[model samples]
Target: MTTIALSQEQQLALSNLCTNIQLWAKELGFQQIGISDADLSSETERLQQWLGKGYHGSMQWLEDRKKMRLNPELLHPGTRRIISVRMDYLPEGSQQIAILKSPEKAYVSRYALGRDYHKLMRKRLALIAEKIKQDAQAFIPELEISSRPFVDSAPVLERPIAEKAGLGWIGKHTLIINQHAGSWFFLGEIYTSLPLPVTEVITENKCGDCEACLKVCPTAAFPRPYELDARRCISYLTIENKGEIPEEFRTVMGNRVFGCDDCQAICPWNKYAKPTCEADFQPRHGLENSDLLTLFMWDEQTFLKNTEGSAIRRIGYELWQRNLAVGLGNAPANPDIVSALTSRLPQASELVAKHIQWALVQQKNPNRKRVRKLSRTRV
Candidate 1:
């Protein structure tokens, strides 16, 4: 697409529109919003290096979309700027450390405790995009405008975009961390044709000398600062990996049945993390602090009903059961857990059956020890 030079009047109107969009975004429940130029040349080398290291594991899509991810214009034609927004997702009264310490409790990732964010975020972003289109049309008639909203559903490099838009700096754990807001939030973007003035101020990396996130990982998923080997990551092991739970990481997996939050929880900046006010993000079905056996006992129908409209539903019942079995194995072996595992063994698929049997062995073995100490729990 050819770039059209905007007159002074058109430039002023676009600047005002950008300002209005921020206010509108706030009204739409976004805590922060920023505009960034579409150029992602700086991130290309880093992304290539990360992909080359085989850090993405089974997530081959990340490698597949390398070209589009580097060039926003390719992903969405006529895109000149990216409007980045952040929505805090940490629910109030989260017992992250408490539930993590209690081996009997099933520790679902705080993000998955509530309804899925994709639909909600996409709807909100689309609304913002429409409002932008309306305002742009009103300002300059016949000015071509095109925008596309993206949550995590697309190949968008949301964090890098957010960072360029002055949202936050990328921390050692590779998550965007605001100095004040921390990292307990979700990011979304609207790729737009409008040449809005980009955010001039970029937040510098504030994670100086703090290797807490790296050291606190149960599976030591981080090989170095700003690098993650997702294959060994608990979140990947529990949620992304389709087959059996790898035996190597199970002992250290603890009670986290869905996803792990150790890196975010251990970040010192999270002390300032704000709890989300959105009802959609609040925990559903008492998942905030459920017991291992209670979740493990959930039949396919029960799992389906409970996880409806929740991110956990994407994993399906088999992977859900497989993860719970690992959690049960990590729990202080009780007869109830043993019974739950034993009863499910016959009906489980070959993949899930292996995990169930592993749980049984863990339940029966009195000498099997937890790899990590429980005293490090913090939120």
Candidate 2:
């Protein structure tokens, strides 16, 4: 642990500052906050093993930053403690399962149903860091404070840090699950030089024998408990992998056009999840319940306009069309859907054209039940 000599008065004031940080976090709309020493030696091997197995798929950045990800001090010089904060982003009326069940309707991950969370959370993290810096100036003038904020960016291993900070336990599905908040939240971190006391309350794993999350995955992305094979993950196939999605997984992809949330939706722990009041996270462009055909008909201009401030925008129009074509293939056969697929085929990029061809075949073959990766009938 990194330590700095502190006067008795400075130690007392620093302890009080920790309490004040949590209060400031709440005011800035964070649901919870915790602190942890920047040591992740135990996770190094697990991360290495996952990468060695090629589970990260085409995300080469994860490999390039392997060294920095394992060492917190190297990622951010002078870092001594990590401040982890959680923000609930599950919006009310998302109707996740309802949309998933309706093959004709698109099922966007609840997280992307609204504005991208990266900017909002990053700004809040910076505010907290600033507040700490100002407080430190008053309490310990002799010692300078240095801090950096991150929200799903850089090489930081946020989940492990969050776990150590007592924000939650990493569940079998490889997501942080809090007994009170469940798993429907975003994580942000601030690497600070402060030697504030680390969080004392470590959450215990409560996932137990429940395998609902694993069994519900449309693509069987989880190889085992606490392990993910990103190549087969619907979220990865739809958002990260720029090439054609593997043919085998397309049938079961269902209507999850942008990202998948089947695992989280089926987890028992999420019964405790709360809705966010933040307007930025509420459903925009009527995306929470739009039809597959409607989204497929959008021109590139319309697609860009509707997704202006959304996380879905990152995937771009071509990927959006490709994913929607897959969803159309899984939908109950319809002539209008067939016509839309045919009309777009001529204009689609080669990557999207192949998916359109596949959708046409599925639409024409109304008699056969599509093969699914999982036994669940919803697929």
Candidate 1: residue 338 Cα off by (Å): 1.1
Per-residue lDDT, model 1, residue 162, is: 92
Runs in model 1 with CA error above 4 Å?
Answer: 373-379
lDDT (Cα, tens digit) per residue for candidate 1, span 38-85: 999998999999899998998999999989999998999999999999
lDDT of candidate 1 vs native?
0.90
Q: Rate the local accuracy (lDDT) of all candidates.
A: 0.90, 0.90
* Clash list (residue pairs), candidate 2: none
* lDDT digits (tens) for residues 124-174 of candidate 2: 889889999999989777667899999987998989999999999999889
Least well predicted 10-residue stretch by lDDT in candidate 1: 370-379
RMSD, every candidate, angstroms:
2.7, 2.1
